[model samples]
Target: MNTTYRKVIDRITAQTLALTEKNREKLSACLERFEWAKNDLLLREGQVCKYIWFVDQGMIRLFYNKRGKDLTEHFAYEGGIFLSLESFFRQIPSRLIIEALEPTVVYGLGYEKLHGLMETEPEIEHFYCKILENCLILSQQKADACRFETAGERYHRLLQEHPEVVKRAPLIHIASHLGMSPETLSRVRAGLL
Candidate 1:
């Protein structure tokens, strides 16, 4: 396996339940590397998300269109995973669009292959379940932040927690993710400074 793929596997093994070497080899075989340029769309609205993508480099944004405006829902950077979880699990069309914000390298596991691995290896199944749980927790946290936190508070929390986002992502995208206008985010940043 290449270094990028190795890095992705290492990250997965570290984050999820420990996997035996045999299982790790099997899982690594299922990963396929892909490269995307900035502005490339991995999954568009209404399309089924076919792969669970592990970012070995660069960044991705998950967004949706509403009233002709693109609203960012989440971001995945190096060492992160990006996928339409509901669409991938349920085999339904996704309402979100996933796009690369920078030249990106990813290792993807096809949905069918993932299911096969889960069925054949108990450890893989456990790992998959843990990933699902984490995804759920993240979703809930985002929802809570939107509901209870002020825009400035949300921006500050994001800076503290995901500083890569503020550093790497465009200001406009950061504003959208924080549920604030560009001007508002600028004011918040000014206040912080």
Candidate 2:
């Protein structure tokens, strides 16, 4: 196994659910590695998401087109797992697009393989369930931030919690994720400085 892939597997096993050595071996066999250039689309709107991607290097962004504007939903950097969850689980077309923000390497677990693993191993199912729960928590946090926090406060919170995003993501994409205009984000950043 690649060292990065092994680290990812070990990290998940530690943080999510424990997998037996046999299960881990099975999972390692199922995972596929992929590399994408910056701006390459991993999942496009109206396409079914077939894989859950674990980022081993670089970054990806989840976004959607809304009334001719791009609204960024999330960013996943190294050591993060991402997918169009609704589409992946429901086998429906995705409403969002996932794109590589930089030259990226990811380990992808195909849906069919994941399903088979979950069917055979309860531990895998539990691990997936925990991942979904974390996704829901993140969704709720974003909603709450948009609804209750001022733009400045949200930006501040983002800086504190995800400084990598502030440092690595484009300002326009960061503004979109924070529900602010680019100019507003620039002003907020200037004020902070």
Candidate 3:
């Protein structure tokens, strides 16, 4: 990891300073990169998720299928974290589906290896705990935003928070993340401009 990622690691864990040099070395060694094409299903519903991913580039969505409709629950872009959380955590089938929105490169760690690392490295454990906490917070925020925010408000907030995504992702994927139809998102954007 570079100084930048080291800083990210530190920010993710308040008690990270106690991690031994050997533990840090292990973390570096476990990091591995994988790539997938647009529309690739990284983990399908009812499948066991194998890896917890950190996005380096491109985009992914976590969604669930219900009555033949896809309900988008989360989106991960560059510098974001992603995984089928329930499957990754509980070692069971996941209801959520993880798919790439564009060609993506992700740094991934297997569940077993991550658990072992967490047991041996307090910092790694704390880091994961923080990750889970942040994920929960974000999930709640997304739910609230979609339920209560106007389309324009949601779009503007997204532009402010993830400007890079506005440039990199297709408009339809952004629409899905915003909990709007593509046409509705277009109208909202036009109205804002």
Candidate 4:
């Protein structure tokens, strides 16, 4: 693995638990590097998600089409992780589509290899559980925001929390993620600016 990739892997365990060099090396061995150019589709609807992807650089989006409209569900920036959770956990075809919104580099660990490692690696298991917990928390927060926040408030919250998304993602995706149309988002941005 490259130095940058090793650093990302090392930091995961370093933050919460100490693992032996051998174990860390074993963990590192399971990951594969992947790169995507801008506008690339990393995963399409109906494909089974085979990897848990960690962003080493750049951005990715998770979205699905609803009634012929593209609705962005989430964005993953540098140091973030994303996958089609339903498909990944259940090992089934996903309705969610994963796309690269920028030139992206990510480290992916295969599901089977990851689960095998989790069986023997306590630290990896802990990390796995943490990822799951974060996913659930994020989902709940988005649901709550939709219920409680106005479109402008949602835009502001997103700007505060993930400024990179506002700066780097396409305006259309941002508008959809905030549960508003592009024109509404434009007005919101204009009013705020």
Candidates 3 and 4 compared: the better one by lDDT is: 4
Which 10-residue span in candidate 2 carries the lowest summed lDDT? 1-10
Model 1 residue runs over 4 Å out of place are 1-4
Per-residue lDDT of candidate 1, residues 48-148 (tens digit):
98888888889999999999989999999987877898999898999999999999988898899989998878889988888788888888999999999
Which ten contiguous residues of candidate 1 have the minimum total lDDT?
1-10
- lDDT of the candidates, in the order given: 0.88, 0.89, 0.78, 0.88
Q: Which of the predicted structures, 2 or 3, would earn the higher lDDT when compared with the native? A: 2
Residues 1-193, candidate 4: write the lDDT tens digits: 5666567777656544566777777778888889999999999999999998888889999999999999999999888878899999999999999999999999998899989998988877877887777787898999999999998999999999999999999999999999998999999999853
Candidate 2 local accuracy as lDDT? 0.89
For every model shown, what is its TM-score relative to the native structure? 0.95, 0.94, 0.83, 0.92
> Could you give candidate 2's per-residue lDDT for residues 90-169 as a string of tens digits?
99999999999999999888899989989989988888888778878888999999999988999999999988899999
Model 2 residue pairs with clashes: none
Model 3 C-alpha lDDT per residue in residues 78-193, reported as the tens digit of each score: 67887877788898999999889899878776788889988867778876787777777888888899899999999999899988778877787788788889999889888943
Q: Clash pairs of candidate 4?
A: none
Give the clash count for each candidate.
0, 0, 0, 0
Off by over 4 Å in 2: 1-4
Model 3 off-target regions past 4 Å? Answer: 1-20
